[model samples]
Target: MELSPRGVNMKRAFIVPAIMVLFFSGCGKDKNEGGKTSPPQAKSESAAKSGGEKAQMPSRLQQAVKEGRISEEQARQIMARRAGGGDKPLVRLGTAARGEIRTHLVLNGTVEPERSVDVYARLSAYVQEVVREEGNRVREKDILARLDDTEIRISHQQAKIQLEQARLTLEEEKNNHQRNQELKENELISDMDFQASEARYRQSRLEFENKTENFKNLELQLNYTRIRAPVSGFVTQRLIEVGDRVTANQHVYTVEDFSPLLIRVFVPAADINKLQAGMNAEISSDTLPGRTFTGHIKLINPRIDVQSGTVKVTIEVNDSSLTLKPGMFVEVNIVTRSREDALVIPRTAVLYQRDQVLVFRFREGKAVAAPVSVGVTEDDRVEIVEGLEEGDTIIIQGAEMLKDGVEVSVLK
Candidate 1:
């Protein structure tokens, strides 16, 4: 414990050198084990050892370091910031370009037949035969049903007898009037009797005309006993059966023309001006999956619906195959406006935050939040009216998790 000053200096010098040697030796070991190997190199070595494959740079920092844009220490610090939730989230990217953007007005509607008619009985009769049933296709003037015509036949026969009897009486009266006229010219009969004969002839002629008209009406009733289709179509409803006594004007069948099915949609009044007759339309149904039907605007109602504030639009779709049925619900898409070569981006890329709409645009390896004014939207694309130019890449798929000035990796 009792040492001189020289002895103290000698002990201090030896201890300092020894400590410096130990520190250098530990630094050499650290360089060999971890410090000299970069994160990408270490990842590659680990990947090769585990699966014998090249490792991929997982972050923007590692990629920057590998590309010599940033030092290893900087990359480590960047990754630390990212892990601590101080950096922006990773997102998938897309490019803004010039493309077509269409504006569509979507409306819900019901499918119906383009033309429909209800067949009714023209005369009271008993249904004796049913020739057509529901879902049966028929042509114009095709017999659909038969009614009992026995009473009509009897009435027709009676009318014919009366007509014949009146004709005979008319002939007899004419002959008598002619004979009376001849006698009156020769003064063989009085002028009064001649006038009486002339009056009887006229009355008989009128009776004959009345009888003939009655006979013709009876004939028409006989024809009506056979109910016929007024137009070519499918029978949607059949109300008559055998032995059913139907009165005149009673509904017997309902025929619907399905060659071109009609879709009735109510569009908002604001969009009514853009719609016109013969505009192309697309229709889809929940009942039919993955199938879209093409159609055109058939008619646009001039009157607006007072209750709904919408205009009635009729679209006609070809259904020659009879795949679409009446009363089926469908979705209709009407193209209101379309622009070619408009600046556009994926609709999913547009983000609405508060009152401002923005998109995360990728520029210089970072996500740059840019405000955008949108116009028309078609399908999965939207028209960018302002704040973006062509060839600019924007984050689309993972933009919801991204913020401004975040490092991004473009996925191939």
Candidate 2:
């Protein structure tokens, strides 16, 4: 029913239809804009092409990548970076800031590769030829030696002849069996004759299989005539030479990677925990005094040296000088603990009164005698590890005159 327009109830029917039409039309728009509304993210573009779910990044990130402002990998790296608790970063104060407490173990160490192998013989024969000597550089799969292959060659030839003979015999037996069957069907040959021919054919097939297997065995044996280096390295030892008779599974040479020699230093159980794989290390040897080789911890042994109460921490060094030799004694320095924006003051600012620790904090351009907490100590600085903050000037050159409310000026 229709009512007068002046009444509020008169417009109800028109408002209801208008809202319903708009809602249904919006639904259609959303449904039709699936792929257009959600463009794939950089990482997911390839995935999307392979029929995977599409991902969308904010328009800013997409634009940044498209406009060459940032690479896709850089964007991914930024996204992967931890928020660091979304807290303010601490800036360094002086050239010598945060006392990087280095828990260095200046003890004995050795050098070796994280990966090494020993050359071993896999077949039994005399060393017919040797191409590489000790301390010589060898490439992987290079022929190190060759065994006396005469026996193997002879065996291979014998196998080939036997196989050929077996083939001919099998063929002859097949023809004999076929002929016997034809003759018996025509009543010219007895059943006994046909059975004998079938038996011969079966026997020949068995002999052929045996010869084929022997031939394959001989082929495999022939392949073992030459001994090749399993890996590229410097041969450290040579155990066999030409005319030397060696058995299978014998160690013939010891090779090692010397490009970046690996050295291991036994770290105390207590100190080992301070280091991890890939931690930077500075190593030195008495053989190379005043020279420090930079490297990183390659491995840390799980088992502790029970006798020494230490664990063997392996180190790989890029000491291109060939200075850090395996079995050479070495001293190591490893950075263990570090902190950012740590409060620090001059070492001379603190006085150790026997068992007590004291420091003079500056306030209002004057010194205020303040007892302070301390941490790691370095060559010229002591970490306040507790007290000061950014821009808190301290007396570096004069600390003995520092006292409560004593006015002072920062040195220019």
Taking all chains together, each candidate's TM-score versus the true structure is 0.71, 0.58
Superposed by TM-score, candidate 1 places the C-alpha of residue 36 at a distance from the truth, in angstroms, of: 33
Candidate 1 whole-model C-alpha lDDT, 0 to 1: 0.86
Instruction: Tell me model 2's lDDT, rounded to 2 decimals.
Output: 0.71
Candidate 1, residues 1-412: lDDT per residue as tens digits?
8999999999999999999999987765424455573456776666655652233435754655575644665554445445456644545577889977889899899999878999999988899999999999999999999999999999999999999999999999999998998899899999888888999999999999999999999999999999999999999999977999999999999998898999988888998999989999999999998988999999999999899899888999996677778999999988889999899998879998999999988888888899999999887789999999899878875576677887876543
TM-score of 2: 0.58
lDDT of 1 at 193: 89
- Model 2, span 1-412: residue lDDT tens: 6656676565786799999999998765422235443333643665544542243555765776786645676554433332223222111112224434422446666666645788788788988888888878888888877888898999899999999999999999999988888898899988887888899999999999999999999888777777777878777788997888898889998878777788777888987778789988888877887888888888899998789899988778886666666677778777776545565666656767677576655556666566667886655567775555545655543455455566654433
- In model 1, the Cα lDDT at residue 126 comes to 90
Which residue pairs in model 1 clash with each other?
Answer: none
What C-alpha lDDT values do all the predictions have?
A: 0.86, 0.71
User: Per-residue lDDT for 256 in model 1?
Assistant: 88
